[model samples]
Target: MASSIHSPNQQLAYQQARQHFHNQQNQKIQIFWSNQTQDIKQMNDFKNHSLPLARIKKIMKADEDVRMISAEAPIVFAKACEMFILELTLRSWIHTEENKHRTLQKNDIASAITRTDIFDFLVDIVPRDELKEDGLGIPRVAFQAGAGSSSDHLPYYYMLPHHPSPVGASGMFYTAPQPCPSLAYMHWPQLPQQEPPKTDT
Candidate 1:
């Protein structure tokens, strides 16, 4: 009996099969925030009294999950932080206003943005290397100084994205698999149309 020899096509088929197997093995489930619409609603509720800006900031800063990921992935961490802060600020403003039951008035959003110091602080913090370091050994004093010393009249809140990815078909698209939560809001209108703000760190 003659021994069978593998042809080039057979070898190529084998390689393809192996590659597919490996690809399947490498696939993983990545959980992330899927929608900003929900965040807007949550912010409105937060404004109405479910959660406060200060408390939200404390949660974002102290949450082990957020802090652990934030050290190595500053941009993502920063964006998440920014989003959280914005939501908290908006919520706080809505709750304080005379019309608590009204729809999210445009001025309320603007006032929330203006009153919340976290946005500007984020503009500075997101760019710093200290916040990106392993262990995220950022000093408390540094945060306080940046937030407190700034002459700008912005009120401080800790709402912001710890991780922010772009939105597009190629980017993260809103879909059923990833339901949009009530606490997700993107500063899309506020963000420049060009590339995302660069990380200075």
Candidate 2:
């Protein structure tokens, strides 16, 4: 196993390596942010983008209620999506390095989702086999069986348009059920439902 890394000095060396990896990752993100700033400042063409404007428009109009879209809206969403992909790639690379792998793999992305809280909504979508193979157990539920509200388990922006309501008490504490779906045809990309990844270390 890659984790054959034992011994105090070896552990220290491993941690230091990880820390260095993290520092490099941070620097890359900062550079990206700086480039994005420069692009925003100098770019005059709003009609063209790296992501297809038509595709972005289609995704925005996926909501039945969304009948109209502005030119700027798609541009904004395209940039946001780009940032999300970049961050996910960087985070996944951390897992790849930890596993001593050169090629990026599915398990790396799954590990990134399991470790990142903002990606919590995606936990249900990672395949059971990938999560298990990564040695990070499946996340079977959105929240843990513990004392606290859904707010305790999730970031503030999870499952937009559907807020969690009190789903009765687990003895003295309230356990949150998955939030009820609001629009049936919103067409959120449904991954074949697998057991949710395990939240425990």
TM-scores, all candidates, are 0.20, 0.57
The regions of model 1 sitting more than 4 angstroms off are: 1-86, 89-97, 120-201
Across 22-82, the per-residue lDDT of candidate 2 in tens digits comes to 6786687688779878977897887766799898798677665588898789898987888
Model 1 lDDT at residue 113: 49
Local distance difference test, each candidate: 0.45, 0.68
Instruction: Give model 2's TM-score versus the native structure.
Output: 0.57
**lDDT of candidate 2 at residue 163, scale 0 to 100:** 47
Model 2 misplacement above 4 A = 1-7, 127-201
User: How big is the positional error of residue 126 in model 1, measured in Å on the Cα after superposition?
Assistant: 19
**lDDT by residue for model 1 (1-201), tens:** 775696677767866765564344224101113345455445432223333445455545554435444333443344456767556554435433423455655444544444445444443333322323456764333222222225222445555455544555567753323333333664445755687878888
| TM-score of structure candidate 1 | 0.20
Model 2, residue 186: C-alpha shift (Å): 14
